[model samples]
Target: MKKITQELIDRFYDLLSPCRLCPRNCGVDRINGELGNCGAGLEVKVASYHQHFGEEPPLVGRSGSGTIFFSHCNLHCVFCQNYEISQLGQGQRVSLEELAQYMLDLQNSGCHNINLVTPTPWVPQIVSGLKIAQERGLHIPVVYNCGGYEAVSTLKLLDGIIDIYMPDIKYSDDQCAEKYSKVKNYWSVVRSALKEMYYQVGNLKLSRGIAASGLLIRHLVLPNQLAGTKECFKFIAENLSIKIVVNVMAQYYPTFNAHKYPEINRRITLSEYRAAIDILKSYGLDAGFQQTIDTLYRKAIPEWGEWS
Candidate 1:
């Protein structure tokens, strides 16, 4: 029912030949088992799928958001909470038709949207499967939940397809991103990606307490200002819009290989969270959700599983 043409699907699948999907631009032939930075093969591997209520309120609503956690990730962050799935192999391979069925199943369960998590690696397969799902009467908003290290060219292919762009503005500095997330030129790439996403869909628009379509950014406040909340907020306010929905996350903890980096191997201090809030307020980017400082103290350990 949507404008998911065969031509659009072909364009995305062609990227897998040399695999120019993400900014990594590894150019590896993923179809032939050649591994790229994300290490995803041709098939659509899925870690999990369910109605997730832990997401932002608008996405969750009353029925809960449909979450399909994809296998592997382009940005292998040292502090990734979902390291088992994103870094190590923890997903089961599924056919394109099966992938489409997952989407339909979620919709049948009364989900508000299809939240595709860490889906940058398998964009080609996702597009093809989404076409099948769209043709089979799937009519929910498709949420592109990803780390902000996206390629504008690749995202262009998803222009008319994706309804909501919920990406994390992970870092405002390339050095920090490279050191922790193993990404190059992250600062520059994320900015361009964010602009393109905003161009496709404007600020987040809610319909009866549910997100209909738009860009909702998430910025996790890392310990000791590692996330550079000030610069990220400033860029969003000045470039994107002050009306943008930015979920300033406080769910950072030492996990996966995060202990290797002593600077970021600890939970963010209360003062640090407050400082990040101050920066968000200074830019008047207050249209989104903000977690209370005490929320961090409740999580003694990193018990929460976060995709971003």
Candidate 2:
């Protein structure tokens, strides 16, 4: 495979000056440190970096995914699990060279891939860092972990840079999306983004039990939201190829400001999760991990070491 280069990095940096990077289309002048709706600028602010074992089995494997948690997000969901980092921007600012070095450090620590968490707003910066890291001999697969509301044009810039695409299909209904994530046209934008992602990477691929390329669509089952889950699965089956790896996550806990919304203000019941699984099975989409209800509350709270 062709390696990411410094020229690519420089080009990405140039594009971020006046950022039109995500679906929000904030067009914030990020180069001069102007904050957008996402509350982020040109420089990357990272909360933490480490090898995370809590991801999907294929991505995590035995070692773990080299996770670099980027601060702030384009779609600031009310029930965000990582609200501290994504909402409050609780992290230190680092240069492109420092971020590249962090990737190398994780690789040296025996991680399987470089997993970028909530990287939509900082896609340009991440791409630049990846190129620099690749030049410095970083060879692990790059995982573009993001919320599903991505801009297709922004993702086009990462055509060859990112190897694995793991995007969350949060909601199938725009009303639910608006009520929960505060994004009005969430489903429409995310559906288009998913199509673009599926077109770019096609179906999921694995080598020796490790994911190298392709898409992994994740749907987190929420309380009193089985119908939404069914709609999302049906759409995936009809629109995209059913051969895609779909992870039906049951790790929904009332976090951040979820209490304000009564519908999703609590943990998902076992029945709710099972109903979602039943819907996926009905569609003949048996591709990814199913989070157990017992395991959901076992570690509900986010730990500092989770970044590690």
Candidate 3:
């Protein structure tokens, strides 16, 4: 693995000036106190941070993945489960130095890895913090948990900085993406982003049942086939690799503003979830995890942050 040098950190911080950190490419000078489309400024805003066991098995093995949830996502998903943080911008802004301490603190708490949730817009600050943390002997794997609407150029900057790439393959259809997430060309953008992510980290690699590095694709089974599960699986099996770890998430409940769309105004039925599993198996992409329908229902159905 290439070392994350001070020069690399400087280059990443430069991106914040023009703010091409994510796919949105708002081009606003964030260094001068301008907010981008993602609603982030020079300071990093965090909703919460905690040791979370609700993540994938590999990520949550033994202890837990130290998750830092960022505020205000780039994609405005109408049915977002965590709308309070992602849409409403509910988080406290902290300096980059303080953010570095959070990473070290998670490591001190015996977290297996530093999992960054919704971290795309704040990549510059993240990289800066990682550099500081590295100097302080922070050596756990860094997980880039994002919504998959990433820019290849931006991801290239994180080639060695990020280890585990846990990204959502949200939609295979641009129409559905635009209608639901208010993002343009979501299919193409995510497709290219996934390819770049795979190229950077390859297939998911585990060490002692815990994720050490590599790519893990997350495909949430949206109701009424809006997420295009079959298409996403086909693309992964053919274009990427069957060896890639894929989490066919079945916890699609109508939360936030999902009632506005009748098609996705309910939880995914058992048959729907079963069909998605069948499709996943048919593609021969079998190295990942799945949530049982019973497990989803047993959990409290609330539109809240995972940190709380």
Candidate 4:
């Protein structure tokens, strides 16, 4: 593994001037306080940091996944359950040192890994913080939990740094992506992003029944076939390794601005979720962790930031 050097940190921070950290390529100078489409600055802002057991069983043993919810998102999804944190940007800015301390603190709490949620816009600063965190004995695997929309160039910068590349494979159809998430060419971008991530770290590796490294994809089952599981699973099975674990998430509940779009205004039915899972299984993709339909009904819909 490559050590997080000051030179490497500088290399990432320099990208802030042009700010092509995400797929948006907004070209805004984030260093000079110019907000890009992602609405993040040079500093890293975190909404919350805690040991969350709500994650997958492998990620959450007896302890929990050390989850850090970052504010703002690259994709403006109409049904974002965590709109307050992702779209509204409800979080506090923390210095690089402070971010490093959070890593150590989470490690001290006996959590498995540092799970960074919606960390797309803050990659540069996150790397800077990791430099400090690693030097201070932060030895646990770092999970890059992000939305599927990612820049391959930006992801390359984190090739060796990010241990577990856990990302959401939102949609296989670009039209659905643009309509729901308001992102252009999302399917094209995500396909490349997943390839790069899998290239960096292949399939999920477990130690003592806990995830230590590699890729775990999430595909949220949307109401009405908006998620397009067949094509998404086909791509993963044919392009990436079928051994790669995929979490077929059925927790989509209408929130935020979802009511504006009638197609996705209601929660997904059990049959809809099951069909998506069938698609996943047909592709020979490992259904990593699953929630029973009864369990889904019994539990409250967790905010995306909190859902892991």
TM-score list, all predictions? 0.96, 0.93, 0.94, 0.95
- On the 0 to 100 scale, the lDDT of residue 274 in model 1 is 84
Candidate that beats the other on TM-score, 3 or 4, i.e. the better one? 4
TM-score of 1: 0.96
lDDT of each: 0.89, 0.83, 0.87, 0.87
Residue 141 alpha-carbon offset, candidate 4, angstroms: 0.4
User: Which is superior by TM-score, 2 or 4?
Assistant: 4
- Candidate 3: give the clashing pairs: none
lDDT of 4 by residue, 107-187 (tens): 999999999999899999888888899888999999999888999998999999999999999998889999989998999
Q: Least accurate stretch of 10 residues (summed lDDT) in model 3?
A: 299-308
| Candidate 4 overall lDDT versus native | 0.87
Candidate 3 ranges beyond 4 A from true positions: 300-308
Ordered list by TM-score, greatest first: 1, 4, 3, 2
Q: By the lDDT metric, which is better: model 1 or model 3?
A: 1
